[model samples]
Target chain A: MLNNKEYLNKLYQSDKPLIIYKTDKGYDIYTDFSRRIIINKKNLKYFLNIQTKSKKSKIEELNCYVGFFGYKLLCENIGIKFPKQRSKNFHSGVFYKPQTKISIGKKIIIKSIKPDFRNISINTKKYLQLNKKFNLNLSLKQYSKIFNDFSKNIKQGKTYQIKIAQTYSKKGNINSIDLFWKLMKMNESPESFLIREKDYNIVSCSPETLILKKDKTIRTKPIAGTLRKTKQLNKNKALTFFRRNEKETKEHNMIVDMERNDLSKICKTGSVKIDKLKKVEEYRDLFHYVTTIKGVIKNKMSNHDIISSLMPGGSVIGCPKISTIQLLNRKEKFDRNIYTGSFGIIHSNGDMRFNIMIRTLLNFKNDIELSVASGVILGSTAKKEYNENYIKAKSLLDLFN
Target chain B: MIYLIDHEDSFTYNLAHLLDSIEPTFVSNYYEIDQIKLEKSSTIVLSPGPGEPKDYPLTTKIYNKYKGKKKILGICLGFQQIVFCEGAKIVQQKNILHGYQSHIKVTNDKSIFKKNFNFLGGRYHSLKMAEPFVSQSMIITMRCVKTNVAMAVEDDINKVYGLQFHPDSFLTPHGKYLIKKILSR
Candidate 1:
């Protein structure tokens, strides 16, 4: 019998598309998919309307499609049209129906249509590292100009809050699986995952859950405020700081209300309520203020309806999802690709879970890109927000060191 | 039917949900003001949106044309619109309060806000009707306890009302009751 790392190495060496999603217990490894669907601007709406075909499977996790929706597709779905901008022309979205699954937790469980026990020697000694330094797409001066413009918009009442994206890129080649494990060891987040495909790869340490639907209950955990962690600052102190700081509290309040409004659209009347109020979540280099809001799903609400109502989540996009998105798209010179998009699974039984794709690295054609953003409100300063963005990208950049 | 004039704001749906609980509500973008079936709607709600009153000319037109004929209510930007259309100078507030909860005190005892008396409301705006709103028909119904800015206004005889704070926010516990009171009138 092979060990957990050996089993993962075997799957990674199989050259088949795979996804290793982190769960509360351990990791769920899916490989050898039976079918794949690639979505674009033309077929997005058509695919959204199509229901997931139910299959006879005793394993609940196996009867689902695992994939990601890109940021552009999400914007298009919500009737937001972007002006012509430079883009890498990435696929809008993709999903896979897996045939083999392995659950790694207290006990190793394997379920597959055709189980493959064949294994080769696994080398767990190598550490992955990037060969080049990552360069930010925007300079401080340029970011200041854009921040001033956004401030003007806020003053003019065009938008209350907006999140601006900045990309850090470099040319490098490293084993994605190794990188995922290394990053996991450094900063393991709840919504983290690793995807290895033929043409591209994605490794995410996303901390925000955009949607988690189980039966009739739907919940979203929106993260709004962030504080850089120091040796003196602890979780309790961070919570006090968030509560006492008027700017952080206001930003958090706006996002909470916006998320509630989003849930109210597809939820039963008066069913939406805050399950967890402003709480502090400790990460490696920062502390985040997060709130969990849940609602009872309205009857006859389809998966499409739920996705449309919650995709490109408000916390990442800022308050007033539609107009803020428009402002961000207009100001951003490049495509967001999958930065703020969602990644998770949609089960055949209509149960689904997705996370906002922040603090993620996208590797395509030997070029790797990591995107991070911070929310700007009325009282936010350009220098503070810019440094905050760097703090968000630090853990990922630290991997190279 | 309560016609909600959406100014392309994020909280419009929450407002719609609030109004729907009182009566069947229909939502239309502010640009579609001319197409609204004026005779069918019992009330007109100018939703909280993202801009100055001067940006939405059609809403101003609708308010001017039907101020006394229909029950009109405004929120945030909508509140500024009501005052701006009534000859009050809309100026930038010294302290912009967005998503800040403020203690509200009802100034006019006979208006609809008399029921709630004083309460906390979620405010999201950067502009306010300049102080000393010298208007003949409009009366300040509520003021923020901290800033003393006009939080609400009413023209009882004209059946027009405005609220500078957002009643549809989760932060405002009395949002439902306040909307109900406005609809009752």
Candidate 2:
């Protein structure tokens, strides 16, 4: 029997970041770092060649690795040259190999042998108190203008769609682990993750999958449209309204089509198919219209090619991805850092899964930063889109309340 | 009765709303047409959707079933399919129109939709009719004033109508009336 409580206490104080990814039915905890892979200008080649090394290290019984890829990796993977965009508070991307991998499910599986657990119950009442007031880098008016500009671009056919994002920040010294555990208990999602890196801790309750590679198949669940959950709103009415909403449907369909195009590049010819379209997923305080696209990995295509083909997740960037990303870089106030970036493990068996970081809170020393974005198309209104940003961030912020 | 073939387009829900009087039964492109009871419905609607019309072979099959039997109105991509099925061609436009409003003039007012008045229409399409008319028998009902592109077409004999513009979208003024005209026929 492993000492789960003792390990949690050690993880709460560990200097190295830990990754906690909840699988479909259970939790997979990655910690006790051993190897490091930093994606930078110098080691870009080695970083892209990670799949071969991972495959070589594969053991049939136990396989686990965890880290994050920043949004900037998209530019590098796609071979688009860009000037070094300044990172505001966090490192863009890095991967870490954990010495110990723990899987808690029907049967507890602990990789790497070392284990400890103290039979102590944590007081659930002890919670982290955070400032409710948030500081926005871009004013509401400025955000509206940016949204309008993107809409104009859509009208002119410069780009079909662009996602507008803004960062909400608050300064405080809070317990990151407590906040994460509170969120884990309060909100349940398919891709809920808690990532702790050197100075920054990422606590995300994301519901979208950037990419999931299982054997020869690659799948992604892109979540585009959103509806705020409310007690007064009838579930049926909301579902019907979401289905019929023109802007919401258009935004979602555009992402789905774009994702299909992205996957087709690395996937075998005629293997890409939309498994699901605009299915509404209900969360604690938000409703997301999700779509699943699946494709068979081409035998000749390396993992590098697959990641390059679909990085930064199409839905987060927008349709006509390249130009839209350039436009976003210019319009948004700060770099995305690890938000909208993905974090997961590449198993030794050539399997991996990464989640899109929405509804996430990141701690950078003195500041707690949270970002939310929405797709802006031709008919998008600034006021409604502004409200949507808040709606997407509400679940994460509610943990503070 | 209205049989709405949902191509997973955002406009399908709105099109369904416009035809609420008929209580349109919605079926996706994935659904097999042979299994559906299309004979019970008097009208068939092909909902607007993304991608090339030829990509959805199911839609072309659905169009064949209701060709001359049921009164059909094809919207956007559906409109492209009706033209393609009728031996016409659809090509990608140099510039795609998405969520744009345009003024359309009624070219052939003598047809069933006898409104000589110019009206606003909503457009969301990347593919346009390469040839304006499907065949010599088809009438060019409405054309955009700015681009001179065919916005609406009809074949009285086959009872198949096509609208390149979205008349069900709220952006298009008096869209419900157009839906009424198509259904009443």
Best by lDDT: 1
Model 1 chain A TM-score equals 0.94
TM-scores of the candidates in the order shown: 0.94, 0.68
Chain B alone, TM-score of each model?
0.95, 0.91
Instruction: Give the local distance difference test score of model 2.
Output: 0.72
TM-score of 1: 0.94
lDDT of 2 by residue, B1-185 (tens): 67778764434645654665445454444355635457688788887765667778987887887688888889887888888888878876655566557898888865677667689987777678886454766777888899988888898888888999887654576787877877777
Instruction: For candidate 1, give the lDDT of residue A346.
Output: 84
What is candidate 1's CAPRI-style docking category based on DockQ? medium
lDDT of 2 by residue, A89-141 (tens): 46657777666666768865666533332222333322233676878777779
Clashes of each: 0, 3
DockQ, candidate no. 1: 0.66
Q: Write the per-residue lDDT of candidate 1 for residues A60-161, one digit (tens) a residue.
A: 667888999999999898889989988988878998888778888988787777556444444343323355688899998999999999988887777888
Question: Which candidate achieves the best DockQ against the true structure?
Answer: 1
